[model samples]
Target: MIKKIIFTGGGSSGHVAVNLALIPHLLEQHWSVQYIGSEQGIERKLISGLEDVRYFSISTGKLRRYFDWNNFKDPFKVLKGISQAYRIIRKEKPDIIFSKGGFVSVPVVLAGWLNKVPVIIHESDITPGLANKISSIFATEICTTFPETTQYFRSKHTRYVGAIVRDELKDGEAAKGLTYCGFTRNKPIILIMGGSLGSKKINEMVWMNLEALLVHFQIVHICGKDQVNHSIHMHGYKQFEYINDELADVMAMADMVVSRAGSNSIFEFLTLRKPMLLIPLSKAVSRGDQILNAKSFKAQGFCEFLEEEELESERFVDMILGLYEKRSDYIINMKKMNADHSTSKLIDLIKVYT
Candidate 1:
């Protein structure tokens, strides 16, 4: 009999990336694939592009740590989601469930546990997010991107499988990337990405230093949805809301990267051997997970980092230049890492549990 798997995750693209990386491989292996996500989430949009995958939407609520007016209504939505997920699990009867943790996943995991189906959770951050922390109780096993993350779980068996990067991302052509961006090979390219939704601070900082930055290097800025400035059309500076089909090529041509320290993005850059200067989200905005990821990468010499709290006008250009100067060292350190087998190892782990 052919094995089947149900995957769940949403909220942000980072939550869905691992599932995207795994789905193609599983499909090749003849495993039936399905996804459960929120009705209007980024995951739904991302997953819609893939063929052979059936998607089911559940009523999900934000699993917030702070109090909010919606918190009162969210519990009912979560309960409703659990019921919906339970029915889906009953009908699909998947051999296993894999979740990249987000609010949408909590209900799916609970439903999987209730259905007695094996469930695996992949936590990309150094620490478990709020949703994953709750889902751990129902998960058969938890996989982590950081080895240090294993210690966070008590009863669950946590495995550090490293980062799972998309295979297509590794095959980008620098020439195609340049052509796509209408940029010349005369100057080094700096790709600036501020997550999927964009960053106000990073955008403002780039705008402030645009003249100085353009003097030294060409730039490809993925400035998130509705954040692109049509008024500023300068030579050698390309601004995009997002790059879907040609993201690989764009990344291929980039000499260096300025980005948020999301685990998925940083690992892809590491796989491509792109020296990066990470500006992680501040503790004020997030739970400080990005800060931890950045710190870990800096400690391992894979990248340099600047905390959001410490972002200074004078040091922004200097730090980026300094990172470029020490690019060789970062590449050498990244080369020492053995992340090539992460996907395979994760697949093996899934099979073992199944």
Candidate 2:
């Protein structure tokens, strides 16, 4: 029988990143890989371009923390999603299902469980996301990025596999990166990443303080798809809608990073030993995962955390400068976090479970 596995994750880049790390390894092992996600989700867009992995989209519904009219309609959509996912799993007969916590993965996990497929779910945040919390019961094993997170679980199935950083990111050329951004090595480059959908507040903060920022650092901003302001033109500032194949080179040229506190993104920064200024999403909007992730990184001396509400142009500019001044100190601490970068351990665990 051919070895086969199904991967499910979506909603945000964090949820989908671990799956991306595993896809190449699975292909190398000669396993047939399939992905299940919502039709319009980020995962479908990111994973569909890969030729080896078969992509399958099903009905999906968002799980909300606040009351919305969609709440009533979403449960029915979830049921429909579960049905569609169940049919796909039954037909594909994947040997295993790997889920990276997201709202879309919940139905997929449940469907895999119903089909008697073994499931493994990886949680990137300090706490389990709402989707992962719901899907945990169906998972045969639960992997976590934060060791502290295992305490909340029953302990038997919990494993600390660390973060999975992509292999392609390790070998970026500074010249290629600089060339791609039309930047020179005369000034230090500061890369700002605001997640998949983009952070409006971060964009505003950067633009508001653009002149101050340009004086000290060359800027390469990943502003999300269609989020760029074509109106702004500056010699030292480069804004891109999004990046894929060129992300490594762009990041390779960066002297420092300013980013959101999504666990996957932060961990990648740590792996690269890049000095980072993190602005986590407010508790009002998210479950405070980013806030806690940022706090942990700060406590470990890996990065500095600035609250979104406290983001003033002057203060934000100061924070970036402060991070730049202490860049070496941050890189030293990040070097000590070197153990988390390896995918071999995660790949081994998946094989044992497979």
Candidate 3:
């Protein structure tokens, strides 16, 4: 009999990439794949078009730490989601369930657990996210991205397996990237990314220093959806809301990366040996996971860190220049770093459980 697996995760790019890394392997092994996620989420958008993967959508409610007006209505949505997921699990009857934690995964996990299907979860940050923490009780195994995260999970099943890296990323062509932007090969390229939705502060800061940045480097800015400036037309500066098929090529041309420190994004850069200037989300906006990720990378010599507060200072451009000067060190450190992006460990567990 062919084995089957149901995958769940969503809400952010970080959560989505973990599941994606595993799907190709599962399919290669002839395991039938299914995905359960929110009806309207980034997960559905990311996971929908994959070959041989059947997607099931459920009504999920975001479980936020802070109080929101939706708090009153969210519980009902979550309960409904659980019921919907439970029915799907029963109908699909997959041999196992794999989840990378997000609010959507919580309901799917609980449903799979109650149905007695084996469930495994992966946590990609240095710390367990709130959704993962809540789902741990139902998970049979918890895979961690960082060694530091294992201690916090407190689960006998927790295993550290570094961040997942996509295989296609290794095929990026610098020439293809330059062709996309019509940029000169003489100037180094600086790629700036601020998550999927874009960061307002980073956008403002980049525009403010556009003249200074353009003089030193050609820039490819992935400024996120709806954040592009129509008025700014400058040579050697390419602004995109997002790029899919061309992303790998763009990455190949990037001499340095300026980005938010999400675990998925940073690990990809690390695997590519790209030196990065990390501007992590602050506690004011996030739970400080990005800050921790940035600090960890800095301590390991994989990247340089700048607090959001530091951007207001005139020295931000100088810091970027300084990071470029030390780029060799970052590449050397990252080259030595263990990269287990192939998902062999996670696949091993899946086979055992199934």
Candidate 4:
């Protein structure tokens, strides 16, 4: 029996959110759960007071593909993380290790492989992250969000599990969300999220053109924690520093969403069958994985993409209007795309491997 499982990943909301979704499923089966992640990452705060889960600190850091001073420090950091992971794994003696794919997950995964514990990795993006790519060799199963991801991994071990989204997103009603956001049932609602850390560019663009957007639609802007006050003033927009347990309500209520192309947000948009306008980060060093994630869904007609470079006030407004005009097409495509039940499939796979 799989008595215990160790989840490894952290550095972004994308990594932490998967674990949050999986926790209830694991508990339903009476499996003891523990988390191994960077002490400084968002996971620490998100899981700080969780029950029946042990959290271990690891000294992990990202290795930039570019030449940089930070790259020089990564080797030492990874080594330290590996040592900490080694100690934690030896002590926990977990039967299975589940990794959600981040640099922070590498050390614990390596330790699990060395200890002969089976490791399962879930890649949430259309493109796999560096940690998932390297860890694939040691992973017993490679679960992916999209079918296209199989081409990147060693063929036999990979499976398309779709994206595992929070149960709240799957269970909520759009009407409830609309009411919470104070929107009239007949009004077209627009939801804008810049990601967990917030996007300065997206915020600025919306601020500059707030009046125009308000003319046609009511907006619920999750401006991230830092920009809440400024974002509220910038457009007199209804803003939340963070939505807490209300994300699903907000998502369901919106007629459309404008968001950064982060894997987690994109998958959430798809899960809700919400039409979206994507603004991918243009910076080179950030991995800009969002661009690839957005392009993949766009190809399937599930959502529309707007490159950050091309995102002007006119273009942004035009895309929103276009989505409204062709709303039925977007809804049909979203339903087709949402046909896959990724979370339940993933839980079943874990049962098999365990």
Candidate 5:
């Protein structure tokens, strides 16, 4: 029996949310959980002051494939991070390490491999991130959100367990959540999320078309903490800096969602059976993955892809209005693609490795 577990990964909400999803299961099993992440990452802010979970800091940064001045500094930083992770692993002495694939997970995963601790990586995207790609060589098992991800990894240890979504998202009643988000009974709501830090392009496009959005549907815009300066006086628009623990409700109540094509965010929309309009980050060096994710959803008839460049104010307003007009069709497609209880399947697989 595993008495101690180390959860590593967290630079964005995508990586952090995986750990958050698995926590309840670990707690019920009476496992002591320790989290190792970068001090500079958003994980530090999200997991701060949480009880029962010990948090340790590591010096880490993203490994960009391109030439940058920061690349020169990475080798030393990675060395320091590895040493810090080694010390933490020695002290904590976890039976297994669970990594959710981010820059922070690299040090812990490497250290765990060297120390003979079993490392399991959960890749939450169709295309595995840089850390997961490298860590798969030493990982005992690789858990993926989509089956398509296995082709990217040479490890025969891969298994498709779907995305590990929070229990609240998995089992929570969508209707009640809609009510909590200030929606009236039977009114179709539209949810908007610009990703963890907020997408300036998405935010600007939504802001430009806010007047049109408020006409037919209730809007719950998760404006993200960085971009919450807009006035919230629309007839049916409610804005939040962050949703805290009520994301399930917001998702459940929404008839359709407008969001970025981040894997985690897309999975949430898929699991909730909410039709989506995905605007992937155009500036990313690896831009094709999200576009592919959006394409898959679109091909499956669950969501529509609206490229960032095509998201002019008039175009966005017309597209949303068109979706609202075809609401029933969108709902049917979303329900068809819903895969809600994926976390339990993921935990069951992890138990085998444990």
Candidate 6:
């Protein structure tokens, strides 16, 4: 019998990224695929371009860390979402469900359990997010990007599968990257990625030190949505709200990267052997997962990290230059690490569970 799979995840691109990487491969193998995401999420926008994968939208609420009046309303929304997901899963009769651990997946995982279908949850951080923590009990298997994460789950079902990077990111050409950016080979390129939504403080720092930074390196800044400053267009600096198709080429030409410490992004940087300076989100705003992710990479000699709280207190430009000087050492450490065939491994696991 042909196998059909239901994929759920996404409040951000990170949650949906693994599903995106896996879906194309499954399609080639003639496995039927479908996605369950929020109606107006970034996932829907990202997945809309793909062919043959049917997309389903369901109600979802943000899993917040702080107080909000919506907190009371969200549970009801989640209950509604569970009903919606249960109905869909019952009708589709998928052999398996893959969740990347977002609020939307909570309902889907619960619904899958109600229908007696196997559900696999992929957690990218060292610690489980709120959504994954809630979904874990119902999950048949849990996949992790960090080996240390398995300690949190006593279940033998939890497997340490390394990071899943998109295949196309590895195919970038430096020449094409330079041509696209109108940059010369005379200087090193630094790519600043603040995440999908962008970082205000990072952008401000970049603008404040633009002249000093340009003296040493060419720069491409993916400054997040509506974060671009069109007023200042210098010879060596390029700023965009976001780049889709050209991101691979940008990665190809980037000698070093200044980015937020999100698991998927860091792993992609590691796979490309790009030296990185990671600035994790602060504990006040998040659950401190990025801080832990950064610490792990620092321990492994993969990158240098600065806490968001230290951005103002530290000599930011000096830190960037220091990282540039020691870039080769970081690359060496990264190269010494074994690379896992994560995408293939996950596919194998899915087949086993199915």
What lDDT tens digits, residue by residue, belong to model 5 across residues 1-354?
658888988878888898888877888888888899998888877777468888999999678768899999887898999999998898788888999988889889999998899888998778887888888988999988888998888888888877766767756666777667766755578889888887777877777777777767778888887688565576677888788667776676777899988888887777777778888877554636778788888888777788876778887887787777776776787676545567787676666656
> For model 6, what is the error of residue 301's alpha carbon versus the real structure, in angstroms, after optimal superposition?
1.4
When 2 and 5 are scored with lDDT, the better candidate is 2
lDDT of each residue in 55-164, candidate 1, tens digit only: 99999999898889999999999999999999999999999999999999999999999999999999999988999999999889999998899999875577888999
- Residue-level lDDT of model 6, residues 180-210, one tens digit each, is 9999999999999898889998999899999
* lDDT at 252, model 6: 97
Per-candidate Cα lDDT values, in order, are 0.93, 0.90, 0.89, 0.82, 0.81, 0.92
* Steric collisions counted per model: 0, 0, 0, 2, 1, 0
lDDT string, candidate 2, 122-164, tens digits:
9999988889888988889989999999986764898888888
Q: What does candidate 6 score on TM?
A: 0.97
Off by over 4 Å in 2: 340-342
TM-score of each: 0.98, 0.98, 0.97, 0.92, 0.92, 0.97
Model 2: colliding residue pairs? none
Q: Give one digit per residue, the lDDT tens place, for model 4 in 1-354.
A: 658899988887788889889988888889999999898887877777577788888999785567788888888999899889988898889888999978999888888898888899998887788888888988989988777878888749888877778886777777777667766766688999888778888888887778898888888888876787552543325888677677877787788899988888887887788888888888553676788888887898978899888988888888988988887898898887536677788877777766
Estimate candidate 4's RMSD in Å. 2.2
Report the error of model 5 at residue 77, Å: 1.7
Flag clash pairs in model 5. 177-249
Give the 10-residue window scoring lowest on summed lDDT in candidate 6.
307-316
Residue 218 CA displacement from its true place in model 4, Å = 1.5
Worst 10 residues of 3 by lDDT: 337-346
Selected candidate, larger TM-score, 3 vs 4: 3
Better model by lDDT: candidate 5 vs candidate 6:
6
